[model samples]
Structures are given as structure tokens and as C-alpha cells.
Target: DRCRVTILHFNDVYNIEERPNTEPVGGAARFATAMGKYRDQNPLVFFSGDCLNPSMMSSITKGKQMVPILNSLKVKAAVYGNHDFDFGVDELEDVTMETKFPWLMSNVIDTLTDKPLADGLEKTVITWGTKKIGLIGLVEEEWLVTLATVDKDDLKYLDYVEEGRRLAKELKEEGVDLVIALTHMRWPNDVRLAEQVEEIDLILGGHDHDYDVKKVNGKYIVKSGTEFRNFTKVEVDFIGPKYEISTMKIEVTSAYREDVEMKKIVEEFTSLMSDKTATTLGRIESELDGRFATVRTQESALGNFLTDVMVAATQADLAILNSGTLRSDSVHSAGDFTIKDLLTILPLIDPLVVLEATGTQIIQALENGVSQYPKTEGRFPQVSGIMFGFDPEGPPGSRVDPNSVKVDGEYLVPEKVYRVCTKAYIARGKDGYDVFKDCKPLTDPDEGPILSTVIQNHFTAVDIVKGLKPCRSGHHQSLIHVASVAK
Candidate 1:
């Protein structure tokens, strides 16, 4: 008798509903169609995780929209990603209970009970004909501190390597023929795990949207990037006492047709959401157009306007924000700025925070912000008050000229204290603002709501374009010049 199993996998499908109107890409509908065709030959379908949360479409529906589609397509199992906890454990439980398939999370522990998630844990052993396949799931514990909002006072994160080794030992003792670790973690961490864990035969990974397959210490590690753009299909042929991987194929689902039923469900959900989000707020006198790189590199009319709003909202002496927070770069046409536009541009729930810091600390914070301009960092500050120039070619710490720094039309005074306004993310040292760690908050930390929502409410009827201007000069001039001239 010949035994075979096929594993169909996808990752980071953040509920993109329709086939992209502009670009050729896979949406949930197209993915369902592709999965249907694949299931005809083989039955197993798995997602590495990050299936829900994020995006206006999923948030509005409270993750109800994707449940019907996943059930129709028959996803066997999925590892839970950090984003799944965005709405907290209760909401996650609600979504899982509604899901037709089982949700897996081997690593995520409930702080209250001091145990792993109740829904799925350790491994799920499925006997396919004569072959017994073991599936284990792991979620990155860093999310407990980085992304999750639930009071983590009760939750404690465990060591992945130790837990993984223990779990593999247990599964091996259970007479499992093969082990598959469905890991929702960074690529580097997955690589490390594969090398360290000897019992693990294969790993289906997510997070850090990169697609590639590499073998570490005889273990196969595969990641199928982000946003449902690509999926991996692994065909396994099991011969008694031995196993062979016949084919590991990565397919682009955008080439296929949209799943009709899934598409219909998505359309209905999107329509209902549109009825609520499509209301016209106010007309823009002209287009508020800019890109993250374009606006941050120099001065952006939109950036300036947004920074001004933050300063006004907090009554801070200065304001700073990251251009990366602005997600979309599309040119807005002269028309009403709907809730859709606002949501697209600023999606994260980062609240505004006002802090009082000595002039020396503010300068230190500015230096730290500029230090992040390198390729890997995302928190480089875009300012509204002070100005300075940086030499990208210069080494770190030496990039910005201290002599050139200025605030409020004068050289930065180390002795003076300035009321600074920035997103709560930075105040908490999220995007690399260690200087803010010791700073005192001028206003209560909980006073303001998410800064993105505040901007939307404040500018409900205003033309943001009218207030657009470059916040910083592109020239390598002194901060004194930037403070005096840009203002």
C-alpha cells in the first residue's frame, strides 16, 4: 500500500477581500478558489497564522467576515499569530469558537491560569491512511509585550526552545511518524529553532514576510511570505519506516479566479462596512499627496499639517512623528476625505502623549530619532518645530552635527525644559526613544485617544492640503536655520 499526504499552506492573509483592483494579487476569494482546486487532489489545508486583525475590512466586521470563507474552504488548522490578539483573548476565543477549523497555539500561555491556550496546544496527531502526521504550533511570545493590550499582569511567556524540545519529545514518544512545527515567529528565530530542535522534521513559518526554504541540521524550514500573495504546497510520500518529500511548490494564487461564494460573502461584508465608513467628512481644497520616504526625507505638506495638529492638540512646545506611520502614499484627489482615507493613512491605535523634558533630553531624543534613519529602523522622527541636518554617509553617532542643532530659533539650551508632543508608542520607548523612558509626562498618559482618530475628528471638515508645507529643508543646513527659516 502506498501512502501520501499533501500540505497546502498560506500566511498573513489579513482579510484583503477583493481581487486587488490595481495590482494582480490573491484575495481571500481567489485563495479559496485555488484551495478548492488543490483539495481535489489532496485534503490538508493549513495557514501558518496572521489570518485575522488589521485592515479596515476585518476590524469593522470584528473578524466575522473571514469565518464563513475559511469554513467553506475547509482550513484544517492554523497557528495563531500576534495580530490575532489585537482585540484580546475573549475576542480571539469568540473567533475561534465560530471557526469551522481548529485554532492552534502551543506557546501562547494564559497568564491567569499559568497554562497554554486551552483551544489548541502541544500537537494534533492526524492519522492519514497508514501515515501518522504530527502538527505542533508555536506563537512568538514577544507579542505579549509588543502588540497585545490585555493586562499582561497575569501572563508569563515561556522559552520557545525549551518548550519546543519538550513538546517534540512528547510527540516522538506517541509514535508520530513525522513532525511539523507550525511556527509564527521571525525568520531568524525559526532558523535557530530548526538548528536547535533535532526531533522536528519540518517547519511551516510566518511573520517577517519572506518566502524561502532552507534546511538546517537536516530539518526543512519553509516560510510563505505575507498577504496571501503566495502559498506553499508540499507533497509527502510515506514509505513504511521512511518518508520522502516529493515536491515543495510555491504557487502564486493571483493567477486564479476568485472563489464565488467567498467573494459574495466578502462583498456583502464590505458593502455593510462601506455604508458606515463611506460618509463624506469634508472636502479637500486640493489633493494631499505624499509618500513616507518623500515626506520624511524633507518637508511634506501633509506631514507638517499632521505635526501641527499634534502640537495644537497637546499644546506642546514641539511635536514629532514618524512618516512610516502614514501607510498610504496615494494622491488624494480634490474631494471629501472619507473615513476610509483616514483609516488607510493611519491604521494603528497610537495615542498622543505629551512629555516635559529638559532641553538636553530633547536634543538627545532628536539624536536618537535621526540615528534610526538607517535601513532597518522604522521610528525616525519627522518634526514640526526644531530642525537639523544629517549626513547619511557619516558613521552612527557622528551623523548629525551637534553644533547645527537648534530649537525655537536658537541653539538648543541644555538647561531649559520643553513640552514635547509625540505618539504614545514613542513615549513608551516603542520605536527606539530611550531618552523618553525617564522623561516625565506633562499630561496624563491616558488623556488622549489614538492619535490617528484624533486627527480624523479634528479635521473632519478641513482641507488638509491647505496646511501642507515642508517641515524640514532638504539642505544640509544648521538646525538654527531650519528652526528660523522653516517656521
Candidate 2:
């Protein structure tokens, strides 16, 4: 018998509507209509996750606004992305509970219950005609240490490879005709899974935000782009277990026909953000590069400017920031920087904190920050008051040379304590940076101004409203990847 089932997949979506309003793309209401037309293939609308937090709307409602939008699209199930944990466990659990679709997580487990984080997150099976297809979800194990807002004590992340094999074996034993591993990890990790697990037939992935379609080691792999701007339409020919895959991109030049049922819902949510988005702050002449690849992989001008703001806000001797804190990838042209821009980029609601630390602790922290360097992990450090050289070829924990560290134009005193400012997330020792956990607080996080307000205040007061280049000299300098040391 020949059966055809189309799988429609998207990942890392947050905005319900497209930006700029001129040639817009990415409205859930529009996406619903775009997806609704495929009635013949019994399309399974799937997402690879990361929609819930760091979004402008997530700030106001802790990701509650996403419920109606996702429900409108009739999403079958989603694998969790790292940003799914940005709002903390209770809020993530709340959003998980609110959605009509099931959220699947095969590797993420709740410690207290020794099970998947929420009821919606259990593994699922889909009946396609006469065949039963099993779906398994997995997140990168380092999420708990990297970007997750949950307490490390309350969660467990089993390695994805082992968990994937176990889950696939069980599903095959259950007589499912095919197995699809849905995941939100690096593309390389996805390839590793395909290499190890022969029972798995396909992997629809997210997290890198690029459009990729490949046949690796005879297993099919696909990743549609981010912002719901593109998706994969996969047709499975059941007679021979063969497949045809292609990517469909929704351009910004137009909008798809509105899904009338979800029109009012999107409008209402847009109304809630009207006042906030309309409020303008300062202006910039040049584009601020907040792209993940730019900030996470190298010294970005915006990253430097931001860490400088943090140092000023706290009056600390130095400051440290993680690249994941800034989310926007588009360069802001010469125009007003609105409250919306600030909130959109730094949407985690993470508070600033100042702590006292010795030079030895600082060196260890820097080593931890760059351990994932050249790989574009979230732990990459953006700094305000330090300059140092590092050897990327060095092993983990030995990359940063302690003697090369200097603070405020002076060499760091190993015995002397330096006042360092950073986010509450770091102070709590999140992201595998446990050194800050023991540092005594010089300024409480609650007493400090939020990230958005600090930047706004700085721009209005000190920044000249002219075409400007990124301020990466003092804050974001490390001599690696350069042809030679400049100094």
C-alpha cells in the first residue's frame, strides 16, 4: 500500500507578527492560513521549540501569549529549545500546561518526579493511515548548565545519544513503521545521532537557525530556518519507506492570507504591546550586530557597548556578560532605539548584580567563559574592564593566561578583590560558572537597574547621536583568531 504524509516543521519562533510593517513576514495568524491549505496530505505541523522566552511578549506575560498563537496553528508536538527554559521552571511549566499541543522531551527529566518535566512533554505516537509512526524528542544535555532557568538541583539531562538509542529501540519494538527524532541541538550533534541510531529514519532539527537539508549516511536530515519564515514540507512514500524533502521559505515581501479565526487573537495581543513598542529611547547611526554568530563567536561591537553599559550602571570596576543575553540578529539602522528594541534584545528579565572577586577567581571565570569559544556557545563572555590574550588551542580550563589579565589599565592583583558586575543568573552560578556563587554581594540584584533601563539612560545622557562604530576596544578584546597580537 502507498501512503503519503507531509510533515510541516518550524522552530525558534516568537513574534506573532512580522516587524517594520512594510514588507512583513512571520505572523502566526498568517502562518496558520499558510499551513491550513494542505488538507490532502494530513500534514503534521511540528516545531523544534524556543518560542516561549526572550521575546517581547514573553517579557509581559512570561510566555503565556504564545499559547493562543500556537494553538491556532494546530501544532501536534514540539521538541524543547534552550530558550524554552529562560522564564524559569514554574513559568515554563505554566506555558507548557497552557498549550493544547504536546511538548516532547526524551532527554530532559524532572528530578522530583523522575519523569519528563510536564505532562504535555511525554513522547508521542502518530497513526498515519495504517502505519503507526513514533516521535521522540531530545534537547542538548548542557542546557541545564548553559541557558536553562530551572534550578540545576531539580532537573536531569541524560546524554542525548544513549537516550535516543534507548527510545528508538523501544519504539521500533512497539511496531511503529518509522521513527523521527525531533531535536533542538547543534547540527553536528544531530548528525552524530543519525550515525549511531540506525532505527531512526529521519531527524527534523532546530537551534542553528539556518535552512539545511541533507542525506547523511543514508539517513534524512532537515532543518527549516527560524522566525517561522521558512518550513520544511516532507512527503513520506510509505510503499518503499522513501522520502522527498524540500524547504519552503516565506519571504518578507508579503503576508499569507489571514486565518480569520486567529486574526482577532493576534490583534488583541498586538494591542497589548502597542504602548511599549511605541516608546522610543535613544538613536544609533550604525547597525548594532546582535546576531548570535557574531556575538557568540567573536568580539561584537554591540556586545562591547552592552557590557560597558553594565559596568557604568553598577559603578563596578569591571563587568562580565554572556552572549546569549542579547537576541536580535538584525542590525538597527540609523534611527531611534525604542524601549521595544531594548526589551526585545535583552528579554530574559535577568537583573544586574555586583560582586566582589579576587584575580584568581576572575581568571578561572574567564577560562570558563571561553571554554566553548570558536563553537559559538552561550557561555562566551562579553566584558567591560579587562584585556587578555587566550590560546583557543589550549584545553578546557587552561585557555586563559592569568598573567595576561589586566583590569582598568592595571594588571590584576591576585590577592586583591575587584568589584565585578554581572547578571543575577551568573551570580547564582548558572552556565557552569560556579565561581560567582561564593562571591559576596556588593550590590544586590534587586537594587540594581534592569539591562534595558541602563542602556537607555546611557544613550540619552552620554552617547552622541551620530553614525558610530561598535565600542569593542576596551570591553571585548581578546587576541585570538588574529594574524598576530596587535600589542
In order, candidate lDDTs are 0.67, 0.72
lDDT computed for candidate 1: 0.67
Per-residue lDDT of candidate 2, residues 1-487 (tens digit): 6777778888878677765465447566667776776756688888887887555565555467788888877788898876675544445666778778778888877776777864335568888677787899987764444432344566777888898888889998998888888898878889899898888888989877778887887887888777756777777767755544444554423557777877788788777776667566665655678888888877767777787766655567888898888888666655787767877687666767788999988888889889987998888888878887788999989998888899988998988999998898888998878999989986545334456545644553333223232331111111111111111
lDDT of 2: 0.72
lDDT string, candidate 1, 1-487, tens digits: 5577888777777756544554437677777776677766766777787665655665455466768877776788888876665444545677878887777777766655555664556578877767777888976654544332343455556677777888888888999988888888877789888989888888888876767888788777888766666777888777777777744555545578887788888788888897767755555556665565665465566666667666654556788786777777766667787767777777776667778888878767776766756552456677877777777777655677767767766887788888888877788877668889899985534333345544543442132223432211111101111132123
TM-score of 1: 0.63
Largest lDDT belongs to which candidate? 2
User: What number of clashing residue pairs does each candidate have, in the order they appear?
Assistant: 6, 0
**What stretches of model 2 exceed 4 Å from their correct place?**
21-24, 119-122, 240-255, 274-318, 321-487
